[model samples]
Target: MQNRRLFLGSVAATAAVAGLSACTSMGGFSLTEAVRRLLQLSANRAFDRLLQPEGFWDDQVTRLALPDMVGNGRGDVLARILTGPMFKDRLAHAFNRTAARAARNAAPAVAEAVRGIGIRNALALLHGRPDEATTYLRGEMAGRLIDVMLPEFGDALHTASDPLIGEVMAALTGVNTAALANDLAVKADDAIWRAIGQEEAAIRADPRSTNDPVLIGALSVR
Candidate 1:
C-alpha cells in the first residue's frame, strides 16, 4: 500500500512538473515551443494511459467492434459472421483487448508525430481552440499508425482468438486483419487525443497545478 501511494505521488509530481514546464519560457523557451512540447507530453501521456487493458475496455468512446462492410460480397459475409449480435459482443471485447495489448508498441509512432511538429505549426496550434492540437496530431499520425501498429495488432490478434473467431477466420481467410488494424489505429489515436485534450484543459484552467517556476514564469508572459 505504501509503495502504491509512493508511486501515485511520484506520478502526480511528474504531472505537476510537466504542467509547470508547459507554461514557462526560461532557458530559451518560446511559448510556441513550450506548447509543442506540452502537446507531445500530453499525447504520449494519453497513449500511456488509454492503451492499457482497462483503458480500451472501460472507455465507451473507444470500444471496438467488428468492421462494418457496406457492399463487398466476401467482406460483407465475413463481417456478418463476425458481427452477428450474439457473437459480436464477445468479439468486440476481445478486439479491444488486443488493441490494449498492442498499445505499448505504438510509442515510437507517437514520438515520431511529436518530432514532426514544426515551429510555425506549433505556434498555430498553441493559439488554436482546445481540440485543434489533437486534430492536427490525428492527421499527422493517422497514416503512420497503420504502419507502426499493424504488426503489434497482428501479434495481439493471434493471442486473442476464440474458437469461433478462429474457425471463421480460417474458413473465410483473415482479410479482416487489415480492417482491424485500421480501425484500431483510428480509435486508439482518438482516445490518445481525448486524453491530451483533457489534460490541456485541466492545466489551462488551473494555475497551481505545478511548481516549476520556469513554466509558471513563461505562462505569465503569455
Candidate 2:
C-alpha cells in the first residue's frame, strides 16, 4: 500500500501541467492524448483572440514593437521624432494594427501547421514544462511563418503607412519596405507565439479557464 501511494505521488509530481503529443486515437484520457488537445486548444484560443479588432494592439501580451526601420526612442533623431505625438497615427496603424489584420490571413497557415503537429515522443515533451508544446510549435513554424507571411505583411505595411512615412523610414534605415519586413515578421512571430504560451500557461494553472475537456483533463491536477 505504501509503495503504491509513493508511486502515485511521484507520477503526480512529474506529470506535465499541460502539453501535446502525436497521436490520433480518441480513446480515454491518456496523458499523450490530453497533451495534444492542450496544444491545439492553446493555439486556437490565442489566434482567435488575436484575430479580433485591435486584438494585437490592445493586448499587451501580443502587441509587437515598432518596425526596425522606425527606430527606438533613444539615440536616433528620426526615431525619436516618430515616437512623438505627431507620428502616433502612423505608428499605430502601420505596425500593431497591421499585424492584427495580417493575423487573419496568417491564421490558416498556423492552424494547418498545428493540425500537422505529430509529436512522436509526446511522453517526453509532456513531462518537460507547461510551455513545451508552444516552444515546439515556435521552433517548427517561426522561420517558416516569417517566410510565408513576409510578402503579405510587407504589402499590408506599405498600404497602412503613408508614402511619406516609408520615405522617412528609408532615409533613416536605408532599407526598403521588403527589407524592413523581415524584422517585422520576426517580431510578429514572437508576439503570436508568446500569446500561445500565455494561453497554455493560463490553462495549466486553471483548466476550467478554457472549459476544454482535453485541457482540463491534462492540466486540472496542476
Candidate 3:
C-alpha cells in the first residue's frame, strides 16, 4: 500500500499531461482512476490510523462502549444493567482491543470491497461532499463489511477476552452469542468506516498534502 501511495504521487506529478478531461473524468483524469485512488487512499489511511491501540480506545467518535452492553442503539436497558460495570469494562476493553486488531486484519476486506464498488456516476461523486467516497462505500458494503469481519472479529474477541468472555457470556443468560458477536462486528466496522470517512474528508480538504496525483487533480476541480 505504501508503494502504491508513492506510485500515485508520481502519477499526480504527470496529471496535467496524463489525459484529456471528459464527462467521466475529473480535470483530465479518468474519474474511474481518480476514484480508485481516492477510495484506496482513504481506506488505507483510515485503517492504518485506527490500527493503533488508541484507534478505538481513545477516539471519542469511534470508541465502542457497547454502552448498551447488548442492544447498543438497539435499546436493551436490561442487558446493560445485567452486564454490570465489571462486565461492561471487560467487554469494552476486549472489544476495543479486538477492534484494533480487526482494523488491521480487515484491510484486505476493505480494499476488496472498495475495488468491487463500481462508480457509475463518477463525476457526481467526485463533486459531491468531502467524504462522498466514504459515503458511497458505506452504502455499498457497510453491511457486507460487517459480514466479512464478523467471524474474524468474533474469533479475536474470544481470543482477546477469553476467560472473561466465557464467564460473562455463560452468566449472561438471554443474551444471544450471535447477537453479541454481531454487535461487536457492527461496532468495529462502524468505527473503521467513521475513521475512513474522516481521512477522506481530510484528503479532500487538502488534496495537495496527500501528494497523490489523482486526488489533487480530481479534488482541485471546482
User: What are the candidates' C-alpha RMSDs?
Assistant: 11.3, 4.8, 9.4
Instruction: List the global CA lDDT of all models.
Output: 0.60, 0.68, 0.72
Instruction: Work out how many backbone clashes candidate 3 has.
Output: 1
Select the stronger candidate by lDDT from 1 and 3. 3
TM-scores of all predicted structures? 0.66, 0.75, 0.76
Can you tell me which runs of candidate 3 are displaced by over 4 Å? 1-20, 23-29, 67-87, 156-161
Q: What is the Å distance of residue 216 in model 1 from its true position? A: 4.6
List runs of model 1 lying over 4 Å from the truth: 1-27, 69-86, 156-164, 171-176, 210-222
Q: Which residue pairs of candidate 1 clash?
A: 24-215
lDDT of 1 by residue, 181-200 (tens): 67666666555556777766
Q: Determine which window of 10 residues in candidate 1 has minimal summed lDDT.
A: 213-222
RMSD, candidate 2, Å: 4.8
Best-performing candidate as measured by lDDT: 3
